[model samples]
Target: MSAEIAEQPAAARRTLERLMPQRESLRELAQGRRRVLLAARGSSDNAAIYGRYLLEVVAEVPTALAAPSVATHYQANLDLSDTVVVSVSQSGSTAEIVQTQQWARACGAATVAITNVDGSPLAQSADVALVTQAGPEVAVPATKTYLTQMVALGVLADALSSGEALAGDLDQVPDAVSRLLQVDVAAAAEALAVADQVVVSGRGLLLGTALETALKMEETCLRPVRGYSYADLRHGPISVVSEGLLAVLVAAAHGPLAEPMADLVRDLHARGARVLGIGGTPTFAELCDLHLPGPDLSEAVEPIASIVPAQLMIEQMARRLGLDPDNPRGLSKVTQTEFAG
Candidate 1:
């Protein structure tokens, strides 16, 4: 890691402490019997998927993750009734998500923003702004910022459902995140390099994480990767299972699908596919390797912890493929739509 990333945890810790949404704000939203609607795009959208899961399961509230355009363009489906709209963005200036937040507020929803930028427009527009302490995201592809977004979102969910008791635990997350990055993800990378095809599978909250992981692999490793639900993986995705195939599983902290997921891993291994488990206390088969460890967070929050290993794996995979992760082809840090006049 460079000096830049080496100090990310400290900066993130400060941001988490200083700029998180006030507990009172979140408690008020939860106490009011409101649902949550998460609006975002790209990786921020993916983070909202996990956040939605946390809100539903932990907070015991109804939640949804909507594409920003869905609210901005498809207004008919938008619901503002007793709803808390959370707009997540790294820049807090993305045109689509920011516009969606405006629409939500105009429609009478309590608006919150989780962003890296402190006083950017989206944050300023929100009724409650939660700043992720990720500092500046220099990489064209998001890494730490996405992780901290989840941290901020997850805490907000806890506060929304369980109150200060649950939200207070967020203070320990920076230390946990720092320790997670210390794991050697090289093993997973080594396994990925030789494989011809890869499938990433998960359930519940981690299912969205599985999708994000697949997208990252596609973006960084330039490989054919797909995300699937644990049960769904057994249907048609297993047809490709073979000696050269790799199946990566994201088994999260707590969920009803854990045992079935374990069965899928075992079945995949039996069919000659290499299995790699990424979760807490993975039980990989004799032929498989596991990359596991991090704080015991809910399944919704495990993806945040898992992102460190995922990035390391991709970094090494990109290096092996003779591609610079710092600069991927046909991609740029910021993208503006054509003819925006």
Candidate 2:
């Protein structure tokens, strides 16, 4: 699992190299599609959350995350004639995800499959297949595959946008990830490893990062961890914050969402939570009890790099807890959930 985590940079480069060339074609699909619906489960679903933001922000198109059960369980027949359904999965064979793609096509939506497997069911059946090129990820928990999926989604966002929204040829991401690998997250990991309560929060673009990070902790660290958007945290989850709680906040150094996140930091601190900041600027780092400063990148793609710190931290945290990430209890690399209907 550690090796798989370290391979993210290379995996991202491979994905970028393969997908960037298809920009025009993918953009053509974007130009014709009136809306988008993304489908996935588990880690891939978190990537879909990121994709939701990217497509809406960059393409100015209405986007939504699909509730596949609507079709699989209730068998609701709805028209998706003008929608583009982009389904993401590390292994394209996950039963429900593949069924979702098949159902979307049945609903008249143009389908796009983003998967690591070249010709898996989900990929072979889509109108366009954007294989992740992340190679075979043997770890029980997804690492390189997740990052590669994000890269592919970012490329799709660029394709959907009128101008270059992702920016910088997307080459900087791998280097940024490589640089973050050098950061010492042991202190933060050690601190959080023994904490009784942990919550991860990020607003806007990095919300998915928070969700994915929390999942990593939950799976590998064998603990109960919750992830919420800063906006939504106040709605319910914030009440649990108090002394001995460890909060990890994903914040950009400066952006529209930064102030609210900073405010969240202050609020968490007030409530006596020990806050660990991720990907914040040096100035913002002062607000955190412990901070792991991440690479400064553009808002559109910063999330790609923003997640690396937590990935590193969570892996270290898992090891600290004496849990083997490769053998995270009761988890398989690919989960298959087929509809019984």
Candidate 3:
């Protein structure tokens, strides 16, 4: 698992190298599309959230994360004409995801499969396949595959926006991730080592990062963790958050979101909550009991960089907790679910 974590930088770089050549074509898939529906499960779903923010904000296109069961179980016939359905999966073999891509195509939507495996079932089904080629992810919890998928989505967004948002500079991400791989998070992971629960929060794009962080912790460390947007975390979850609660805030997207996140840190501190800030913003980092400062990058690409440190921290936590992250007890690398039409 740790080896895969270390491979993230090179894996992301390779994904960029492969996808950039196809950017014109990838963007063309969404060209003239009225809306986008992203479908995935687990870590890829979290990456889909990152993609959702990028598509809506950067590409200026309306996007929604797909609820596969709505089509599969509820049987609502959605007219997806002129829409794009992007399915993200590590193996590209998830039954529901492949089926969703197929049904969306049948329903008149352009289809895309972003998967690590080339020519997998989902790839075979989509109009264009953005294969990560990140190689086999042996660990149950995803590290490299998730990062590569986000890179693929970013490439598509860059294409759609005519290189405005990302500015044809997605290549910087791999080095940024490489820098984050060296930061020490052993102290933070150790401090929270005994805690039974952990919570992560962020606003806007990093909300996806927060959620992914929580999921990684739960998957590899075998602890109870939940993530929510900055506001939603306060709505009800804050009621139980008193002293000694480990609260991780993803506020280092290097934009307007950082100040408000610092405010959340103060609020949590006032309640005696122990805070861990993820990002490089000085104001926010100063307030946290622990801080993981990833490379400062455009908000569009920060998730790819920032999440690396958290993945490393999870590896450390697994070691401390004396558990094997690569083979978490109740989880499988790919989860399969299908429904008959």
lDDT score for residue 59 of model 3: 86
Best candidate, lDDT-wise?
A: 2
* Clashing residue pair totals per candidate (backbone < 3 A): 0, 0, 0
Q: Give the lDDT ranking, best first.
A: 2, 3, 1
lDDT agreement of model 2 with the native: 0.86
Q: 1-341, model 3: which lDDT tens digit per residue?
A: 99898898899888988888887786767767878899999999999999999888888788999999876777678889979999999999988888788789888899989999987999887888899957788888998999999999898888777436684458789888888889998997797687656888977877778899999998888888988988898799888888868998888647777678888888888987889888847888887889988676888888877788789888898889999978988887777664346
Can you give the TM-score per candidate against the true fold? 0.88, 0.96, 0.96
TM-score of candidate 2 versus the correct structure, residues matched by position: 0.96
Per-candidate Cα RMSD to the true structure, in Å, reads: 2.7, 1.6, 1.9
For model 1, what is the error of residue 332's alpha carbon versus the real structure, in angstroms, after optimal superposition?
2.3
Task: Give the C-alpha lDDT of model 1.
Answer: 0.73
- Writing each residue's lDDT as its tens digit, candidate 1 over 1-341 gives 23333555675577667655576787775556468889877777778888887788778889988666566677655557688889998898887788888888877788889998989999998988888777776766677777778878777876776543455556666666678667777777877888888888887777767777887778777888988877687688678778888888877545676556667767887888877877634443333455555456644555666666676677777888887776677666555433378
Give the per-residue lDDT digits (tens) of candidate 2, residues 1-341. 78987888888988899999988878777656699999999999989899899788876778999998886777679899989999998899888888888888889988899999998998899888999887788778888888899999998888888765675847789998899888999999999988989999987878899999999889888899999988789998788788999998888766777666777788888999989999766656888889998776777788888888888888888888888878899887777675256
Which of 1 and 3 is ahead in lDDT? Answer: 3
